[model samples]
Target chain A: MSGAEDFLRARGLWRRKPRGEGWLLSDVRLTVRGGQRLAIVGPSGSGKTLLLRALARLDPLDRGEILWRGEAVVGNRVPDFRRHVIYLHQRPVLGEGTVEDSLQAPYRLNVHRASRFDRQRLVEWLRLLGRDAQLLTRRQRELSGGEAQIIALLRAIQLQPQVLLLDEPTAALDADATLAVERLIDVWMRQDDTARATVWVSHDQQQAARVSTKMLALQQGRLQGGGSC
Target chain B: MLNPTYIELDASRVALAALLILVNGAISLALRLGMARTLLVASARTVVQLVLVGMVLQWVFGDRPWFVVLGLLMLMTFIAGVTAVQRNQRRYPGIWTDTMISVWVSSWLITSFALLVVIRDMQPWYQPRYAIPLLGMVLGNTLNGISLGMNALTEALVTRRDEVESLLALGASRWEAAAAAVRHAVRTGMVPIVNAMMVVGVVSLPGMMTGQILAQAEPLQAVKYQIVIMFLVASATGLGTVGVILLGYRRLFNADHQFLYDQISE
Candidate 1:
């Protein structure tokens, strides 16, 4: 029903029995154009996280197709797709070192080992999210939920992926922390005009209204619009 | 050091050794009735197992065939895997992979050290004195090491998984994120051996030393051999424990560097 010029696209894709314990995921289609912020929200067990995994290709789908830059992201190439199209979960899985180690994470990974990150760049992002410089040198297990979420967001953004997927990025934070994360999300969408599209999942109505230009709510394994901005 | 007469171990001496056994057994029993049952089972099993081993050792040690050593080595691997499964709940894949790698590295290291380095002139039909007992000691210690390492690694993987993934997100390869946990686990798991090595002679005489005395070896000879075995246990524990954890963590994390959800089903 639309022109096929999107940067990230998924159509008619499904996944089933991923871990072989009789668990399954199917019927997932998602797309995000460069600079667009799309939120996919639904209750637990409605397959929101599974759909994210399927689209990112972290978990396999039994049917349909995912396209990155118009090429089918199927077969073994799914791994490459998942790598470049980043995904973040509710709890930030921070590494075992200082704040600085996490911020420079992408550059150390195999996929992005050639990339570079400067302290100032991270500091710039941190400052935008209203964080001080001391947050970077501190240990991983020492950070508060809000700081960790921001650091995780900062790490994901550092990858500069074509599309970023977030599942409940601030679900574990307080009201002030949630407000801070909301601002970070807002800043991240405006990070660069055509840098990376974002697909954020949340149940917060005010958040969905704040920064999301496009929205989809999952119900019984299908997406429904929620007053798109 | 004293060569107590054979008659020195008569009724009075027998009565004294019996009293030591009974005292240790009683204290062990008071630890817990359930654990007491387990400890008793372990003691009985050890006695029975070593006796059965003694029966096999006659043929194995006397014949000293390479094939016999090979067979024993395979049994060592099997025992290591079964022990790892028992400790780690290894119904899934990768657990065996870790154990196999650990056994290969540690057993080989200890065996070569024993045969080529320590007890040189390893006759084509090596003395079971040098080979069998050493293998049993190394294999048994490696089993405990691998189990402890697997415990530390899996616990770190499942519990602090978010930290691991975050490290990956931080841009660490699967290996780097896991290295912290692996290193942490290895340090923790290897502590008992490390501590034991540090405090060996000063605090208490170990079993190997005590056994050598029982067999009437000279004090100097027994102490020297005890040192060698203590080092062997530490080396095997350190290397094998680190090996299993690092390798296991690599498999647990995927190619895209995402920590696989449902990694541990049981």
Candidate 2:
């Protein structure tokens, strides 16, 4: 895989004090090239999740510039940029109805109107996760935590984002489910003709070593260099 | 075909009605409701405010100047907006300005449409007798609806911030992401008006209709007028609630469609 494709980059990224408090994140610099899986590891309150959210443009940044394919993501382009750079939380918040409803949500947005829900694609992912097409009709309440996370992953994965900013995507799962997720992501990253990337925030060191090709550590909102496993 | 002269309440009769407050105070004391002080203060405020309003209305009706009418309407709208804002336990950055504009635009549009197009008998359109009371009714009801809706909107955003952010991450614009909370708020604001409409005559006599009947208008005529007012009220409340939600949601984001965390205090 070519490592030359800088799919997403963040420069001088920091979060301002919302009120009178200190910065939650400061002077962070990071880049994710195509086919790269960068893991961010930190203790709680270390701003690991904050950094990922900022990259996805979900959180307000104090001062920063995020670029997609070397162009700054701004204004009317933010939605389009977001369509390709998705963020997933630890516990998914599902909309009302079956898993199918949650999967079909993005196509309803004007920014993603050009795309349609591909049930075949969803079934393919579900099959990889040891499920079948029948899982699509199950209500949100019926799904376990692992199942919910998988659905949330599929929701973003189906969108075919260039970079997936996952904030502990597998932290709430069991061992088998965790492996399933890791494998699903492996297949997903390879499916794109060009390189796709991920910034995974995980507290589990072993999992981090397994999933990430490169690693970064965050402490008190500052980024530091690290080694790949 | 009823007697045209309205039944006038003499000073004695008015005083007799004022004594009804004493009965309420006595009941509060006897029941140990701890509401006697509130009752006393509220009664005093009501008497003073209504008397002052009565004199001002008399003056407005006598001369019927356009500016004075418009000035009074603006003042009413301002007070309504502030009242709604004050109802929120937490404040957003520019919520006061947001609520004021929402209230004024919705109330003015609906009230004018009702007076001019629906009830064309009020020839000058800003005739103090019709305009003042009509504006007051619409503004008052709209205020309550907007307050409930604004409160609901804020609470939903705070509690569901995760869900909202998730949607935003999924290429949803600020509007699409916040659409659920907006719809919920607008519906909440209009629920009171809808409930009132449902119980208009069979369950209870609405205030305006009862007042019209007491003023010796034909009961049927009073009912017709009450229906018109109720329709105007529903329209105004629905519009005001929607305006406040749309504006409130817009303010929660910056120009770049990023959620403005600083704007949310709760």
Candidate 3:
């Protein structure tokens, strides 16, 4: 596999205090190449999630430029950028709806209206993730943490995002479910071309060792790099 | 020591309502320091404002014309807008514009439909004793429904914004994502007024009903007026609340169609 493509290119990233507090991030520079699985590990409140949010443009950056496919994207059009590269929060807040509705939600916005969603591929994804395709008709309440997450991942996958930012995607699942999630991401990563890149925040060293080809650990908000392939 | 008896217009009875306002006001004050000030100021303002409206009604009821009727409609709209923003300003940022237009159109059309078609000659185009108070009650209550309806719906939108954004990310339009919340709010908001309509005569007599009796109007006549006001309140609440909620949606979202967390967040 070629490690040459850069799906997300961020430079000189900074986050200003919302209420004039000190900067959350300052002079942070990073590049995430296409199809690269980078783990951003940190203790709670270490700004790992903030870094992920900045990458996705979900959080404001006081000064910096974030580019998707060489187009400048920052404060404005964060949601638009997200359409191409989805941000998966650890505790994903899905609405009061059936699984199918949650899956089809982003399509409801004008930004994603132009893009066509392939639920047919979703059927395969559901099955591959050890979920029942029939479960789409069922409400979100019926799904377990593991099942719900697979659907969340599938939601991101359906976007066909070039880059995916995952914050504790498997943290809510059990060991068995975590293993299954790790494999699903692993197999998909090896097979999917440079079009799909990922930056995941995980605490588990084993999970990190499983999917990420390279890992970057964060200690108290600074990058401490280590990984096993 | 003199014991105060409740008189319909007795300052004491009025004082009782004043006391209700004071008690509610103080609690409202301590609970919401900012809102407390607004409530007290608004309550005092309401008394002053309503009295001014009462005088205006005396003049308007003497004769009803195209301009006068059309103008009173404007007044009703104004009242509704002020009421909504004052009651719950947070949910309704920049709402005064659309709300003014909406409240005017809906309340005017519905009230007129009832008056012209339903209560044909209860006129001089306006009757302070009848039309004035009727409009006030209906408009005031409808304002509440709109405020509440908008509040609940926007809240649902905020709380479920992720679900909303997810829908938008998928393929749904902004309105469709918000459809559940807005529709639910409008539907539920109309319930108190609607159920009141259903049980108007037997379950409870509306303020206007007991009001007319106190004024020495015939019982049957009072019942008829009560029915009209009930219908007006129900229709006004339903029609006005729905319009306000739907119109308020566009303002609630940013250009990216994301709900403004900064604006709506507590």
Candidate 4:
């Protein structure tokens, strides 16, 4: 099952409680192939976020290794790995600046030093989402929750990462904003379908069915069932 | 001008000054603050600790060898390190070692520069009378800075865990992710010494300067020494704060750029 098409693979991924108690996530294995939109659905406390974080290598793994393009992701490569496999928090955190500054922030990182912010592309995306270039000039603190999430999503997508581990990116958005986010992700994935994939952790099964071709269910820190929607 | 003679105080005169604690004890009693016992114990401790330190300094100043002087300075550095860490309300693994390294390196470096390069006329650079007092002032101030910086850094890291993690997730190196917190911590640590510098001659007469003046050294000479001490303290504090904060940043994040926020405990 691990093939060239497999962009990211997690085998026997496990994370223990900080106090050395039972596992918060254990024995979870999944594969993300190019052009795959995988949605993980679970009730609260089901470790969906934990699993996504573990996959992104944002959280330490106790029992499993994450493989990128058929090689084990290890030290030194982790930074570059994270650069390609970006994780978006459920509630976005934006620094104190205009939306453009927040978008430009990632390019400042050493990993993305070669990348430049594409202001025109951002404005075009904003037009598609029914926003104008003025949104970029708005102060981040003045942004609505939906606007902040939009900026956060654009920030990650602009980096052109190969994989996105989105932890309920729209959990705080209203219906219209959610649709805008889903549309943006759809457009981004299709732009380079052969090299892109996303793992969405959503509470909305209907939205999951709409956004994902493959769906997985999690419960009590374990995978229960997974199949194409 | 006549040479001014220094007046000496006997134990009886010191005891008379010690009676001032009774005023504090009476206030606590009147207010029913239940702090009278603590007040008495702390005052007693102050007298005992100072007397003990005075005795130790007397013995060391009595023609002690260089090794003995260095040993006493090391001891003072160790105690300052421990005290700095103990003042923290949070804990993490290896924090003590980090604090110790910062305190020892910063204080010793600046103290040595002051003793060797700045005050070159001493027959021996490690003379107890000069080195001990210089190192003590530097160590004391550096301890304050390290304690303040470490506390602020750890607290910011814990409180701003999500912000840090978000930055890490976006491919920020550990240094980039922690830059804001490091700046804040370093600034916090250096504030005291900076403020002391601002008010040194105008708003306050520093204890060392006052002591030198009482010891019949020329007032201008005392001012020069105090000026040197202030600059030494500011440099030591700034260096210690930066060192400890960087060390702490390394501890809180890993080589993979992942934030190990759980390592810290309130």
For each candidate, what's the DockQ? Answer: 0.32, 0.70, 0.16, 0.72
Clashing pairs in 2: none
Q: What is the lDDT of residue A94 in candidate 4?
A: 87
Record all residue pairs in model 4 with backbone atoms less than 3 Å apart, i.e. clashing. Answer: none
> Pick by lDDT: which candidate is best?
4
Interface RMSD of 1: 4.1
TM-score on alpha carbons, each prediction: 0.78, 0.90, 0.67, 0.92
Ranking by TM-score: 4, 2, 1, 3
Model 4: iRMSD?
1.1
2 or 3: which has the higher DockQ? 2
lDDT of 4 at A61: 84
Evaluation by lDDT, superior candidate among 3 and 4: 4
TM-score of chain A of 2: 0.93
lDDT of 4 by residue, A1-229 (tens): 2343888899888888888589988789898888888999999999999999999888788898899988888777887888889999999998878989889988888899998889999999999899899999999999989899999999998888999999999998999888888999999989988789999999889989999988899888888753222
The lDDT of each candidate is 0.72, 0.86, 0.71, 0.89
Q: Report the error of model 2 at residue B157, Å.
A: 2.3
DockQ winner, 1 or 4: 4
The TM-score between candidate 4 and the true structure equals: 0.92
lDDT of 2 by residue, B136-206 (tens): 99999999998999988888888888888888889888888888888888888889999999988989999
Identify the CAPRI category of the predicted complex in candidate 3.
Answer: incorrect
Model 1 chain B: lowest-lDDT 10 consecutive positions: B1-10
What are the per-residue Cα lDDT tens digits for candidate 3 across B1-266?
14433334655767678887788778877777566677789889988987897687667666656577567766767867877766763644566776776677667777777767777776455544555565677788788788788778767877776776555443344566678888888987787787777787788877877876776778899898777777788888888888888777767754444454555644
